[model samples]
Target: MDRMSAQKRRESVIRAAIAEFARTGYHGTSTAAIAKRVGVTQPYLFRLFPDKKAIFVAALMRSMDDTRLAFERADDGMEGGGQALRAMTGAYAHLMSTCPETLLMQMQGYAAVAAAEAQGDDLIGEVVRAGWMRIWETVHLSLGADADETASFFACGMLGNTLTAIGLPASAGR
Candidate 1:
């Protein structure tokens, strides 16, 4: 088999890490599992990432970037706040249904933040908060910079995430 480049291996590790972390969370996931998923040895995974925390952070960042791009793409060439809002909403819904792992990884990121903060480790929280702000800003601008509208949109999105995490159908309370 052909050998993968370092960059490609790193990307594979990140993808595998996302799935593993989504399933087991930061505290529960082990580097061995991530390496196994990526078809690499644990030492090679470490060479790609300094430690498990690094791998988790990379996965979390990727998930956030993916989300931000989804909103941006959905709002591309759209006019009017309501129209952009609907487009972004549809994009998010598609992401939820098709890329459930991303959603799960995002939730796990939030949970990991709280866990890390309690132990006086704020790095994870910092990364998550910054990433979240990027998403918020993207939505805020796409929604015509209306603060109330942006808040309402995120409020609904968070609720949706919670519902999905709990295995509630999209039509559960409707």
Candidate 2:
């Protein structure tokens, strides 16, 4: 395949994989399913990612990075946590309108993590914690809080609020 076509194919697969993995979990998502979704075969999917796990990991990493970047960009225009969160929420609401699949994938990942926890697996938990700490640290710095206790104090609280907001969006008025 040509370079652009290959790149497009990869993106299509990733998008489809995100939805599939989100719906099916990492273990349940099959290469054939993703390939079929991307209008290819199982072997072609393998050409992009050696295995399903690798693709799921890549998608999760991309999601985390994208969230961080979005937060930073939205935060840049505001001076306080409340204002920043408003902008961030607006961005999220906009995203919710535009790219709902990304959000759905994230929600699916959380569900998969919960399922993993039930099965005595902690991979998603560790990954989620690390992703959270990064966000909390950023929020702490934004708040001009003491760095020494930031992770445990502000970061922890912020992380809790975030999960809560995501989990209880309707109840939280988010």
Q: List per-prediction Cα lDDT, in the order shown.
A: 0.90, 0.65
Root-mean-square deviation of every model = 1.2, 5.0
The digit string of per-residue lDDT tens for model 2 on 1-174 reads 645577788878888887787566677888888888888888888888888767776676566666666657777857855566566656555554455555556655666678878989787777767776676666566545555544444333344345443554422432
Model 2 misplacement above 4 A: 1-8, 114-122, 143-174
Could you tell me which residue pairs clash in candidate 1? none
| TM-score of model 2 (CA atoms) | 0.68
Candidate 2 lDDT (Cα, 0 to 1): 0.65
Cα error, residue 101 of model 2, in Å, equals 2.4
CA error at residue 130 for candidate 1, angstroms: 0.5
- Number of the top lDDT candidate: 1
